[model samples]
Target: MPSLRNYDLFISHAWKYNEEYYALENLLSSADMFKYRNYSVPIHDPVIDPNTKVGQEKLADLIEAQIRPVQCVLVIAGMYAAHRFWIDKEVAIAQSYNKPIIGVIPKGQLRVPESVKFAAHEMVRWNTDSIISAIRSRAL
Candidate 1:
């Protein structure tokens, strides 16, 4: 069995819809089942910035740097994610790096973006067990 510490994740989220992102983070860090897990984001994670004017190639390079070291990429499957170009880019970069992409459907959400569904290697509900299982089982 792989220890929780073995999993590192890059979370892609839209700044406008940060509630799901924060909730996911809280669940991963505060849940008793995941108490021993060391899943984390980089200190200076750039995925939150949705309005950056950086060139496409430069942005991809930066995002790639963040995704390369992680075992998987977690994308919040909200409707807005489909419209965010950066989120799409992030997913593309994750794919280019051969990292597993885990789509997390936020609690109470019934519909998710098509891009998220297409990009995800696996999809899990907003529960600790499911999320952890997806990360551990599907991550590369």
Candidate 2:
């Protein structure tokens, strides 16, 4: 049995994309939903050796279970997602479920990760204030 929870969004991104992660999470922090317990951040499963196929499958299963209840998957698109297995896997699962997915590109010249763009249902160029506004206003 699953524990019941209420949340309107899930934030997913590659851990390598640390800057984007903090920026986007900061945006969501000001949202009323965040304060009201209507949003969540997906917890990453521990990394296992790449050569362990069974471990990889188990990790994927763990992530899928954690993300299933989320109403939307918000991706912070940074430059390295194509090289990150877990980010790709998470985006694929979210897309397969027809979960609403959005990507916010971090400021400066950071290129949008191909995996992120591929999975994004909507995309935005994030100015700092606009990112906060989008989340706070629930406009994205």
Local distance difference test, per candidate? 0.77, 0.65
Per-residue CA lDDT of candidate 2, range 1-140, in tens?
A: 55433346667765445666766666665544343232444444466543489888887776687567766677777667667887788888887777867777867746787778877777777765554434444422
Worst 10 residues of 1 by lDDT: 35-44
lDDT of 1 by residue, 1-140 (tens): 66545467888866567777778887877755443322333344465343565555665676777778888899989889878987898898889889899999988989989999998999899889899888778867
Model 1 vs. true fold: TM: 0.80
Error of 1 at 44 (Å): 9.2
- What TM-score against the true fold does each predicted structure earn? 0.80, 0.70
Which prediction has the highest lDDT against the true structure?
A: 1
TM-score between model 2 and native: 0.70
Q: For candidate 1, list the clashing residue pairs, or say none.
A: none
Candidate number of the best TM-score: 1
Worst 10 residues of 2 by lDDT: 33-42
Name the regions of candidate 1 deviating beyond 4 angstroms: 1-4, 33-58
